[model samples]
Target chain A: MEPLFLEGKEDTPKIILNSQSNQYLISGRSLPEDATSFYSPVLKWLDEFSTQTVADPNVKFEVRLEYFNTASSKLLLDIFSKLEGLSENGKKVTVQWYYSEDDEDMLEAGEEYSELVDLKFEMKTY
Target chain B: MENNEILTKSMIYDLFKEMTKENITLLYQGDFSQNLMKAILGLTEKKMDNIEVSTNVKKKVFNVLVECVQNISKHSDESKEPPASKFTSILMLGSVNDQFIISTGNLIENKKVESFKSKILMINSLTSEGLKNLYKKIIVGHSLDEKGGIGLGLVHIARKTGEKFEYRFDKIDEQYSYFTLKVNISKIK
Candidate 1:
């Protein structure tokens, strides 16, 4: 329905969803004080998007997270699983995982997430 | 002494700066009563890569470090002080010659020593591909701890580093043990 956007923090990442453009972006560090509270809404938004998505929706999900803790990694997995499920059900999903050229850990993180899910993922080095 | 603590972290920074020009100085999951462990990991990952390095070396270090930190976060639980106190654990990312090292330390439960030893022994024996296969098996076999299972972390550490993870479980009390594990980050030839 409406746009869903949450800003990133010095310790947390920003989440932006453009329902109109069929584009979603999650960027920054993710170690929220309360992980469940932080991720539940994002999951909810994705669920809603799946239902009210635009015609011929080719969703572009960009992840440029500098870091995420183990707990947040689980949350990201949950989100990707959902996206994977949506894609499996014949929705268009393209994921771009961004990392600085020097950030090996971040790149490997993207690789781990890619391994765990079945989405169209492109690991981009900035 | 309270104010002096800040100097230790600063000194650590200086030491790391001198150790290598790579700037891989992140410490995690120590002493803060809350979620300091996660904070440390979050901060470190932001800068844990060296773009100048090859993809193979980069992947090797990244995987080892993740395993090391996850082990620290999941098992070690020594808070600093005053009952609900914060504690300090140190992680140093540096190179000895050309090989990178990920060192981590935290408090442990004395009783878990045997389990820790066995896991290390088991992990050190596997080849990289074997470790990967084992990880997949664990995932499919539903092997998980109450929080999140780090069974795979050890295997990944062993395989990625191509070296035994050096760990010392020092006894603090009958109930507590201090454990430190170091993983070497050199791609296996």
Candidate 2:
């Protein structure tokens, strides 16, 4: 499958998923006016990636969000749940949650997501 | 200048005096759209940048502010006997002592008051851990209304600050009631 690259904006995040590289990234702010619509394509890509039969089948999801609204938070949870499902299917799926050392809120948010999802999460600080 | 058009000295003096007494740092009372909301957030962001507080505290204030204003913009009553243009709301941010206060007021149908009040009471009654559990439950459930609200905003504000939320309703006629919600965040700790 081809990679998906979305540019970041003031109200949206940058999303990059490369099936060949087995690397996925979601970064920047996510406060879209209509989060569902804004994230639909990325969700679709995830769905397709889950069904694909890859050679190695190791995935690493990196999330580095400075800020996100409540709606975006729900969508993020959905994304994590999807990845958890992928992990349950015997694929090696890991998640890296990145936040600044001083951002306690973001750190706590990462911890909460880690607790909720069944995927392996590495809390990375910058 | 005509009497109505001319600036009355007493009115001007009284307004400043009232503002000083209330300690209001920023106040906006008018129609609230997405553009206006962004502008208000920008203004507050610039103002908050100059203050000596942690990024966590700033995030808390910003999150609480967004939720409060969005609640007003999305759920406020649009239909009333008096024809109130359907988009008017008020937001006030102030600081007293070592804490920051954000207050928002808007019109709402009298029928929906009980549910909102009960929900707020439930939120206020929960411990911080309980609120976290509730937040997790809501996120997992993933049932949002048309306006994208599953009461997550209120839950987040409550969890972020771990502070008591102050709210009240004033009767504005038979059909409409004005709802005001206030959230306080301490700068220290």
lDDT digits (tens) for residues B19-68 of candidate 2: 88998888888877767777888888899899998887887787777777
Candidate 1 TM-score over all chains jointly: 0.66
Estimate every model's Cα lDDT from 0 to 1.
0.67, 0.84
- All DockQ scores: 0.10, 0.56
Stretches of candidate 2 above 4 Å error? A88-90, B5-10, B83-87
Q: Model 1 over residues B90-114: C-alpha lDDT tens digits?
A: 6766566567677877776667788
Clashing pairs in 2: none
Model 1's CAPRI class? incorrect
| Stretch of 10 with least lDDT, candidate 2 chain A | A29-38
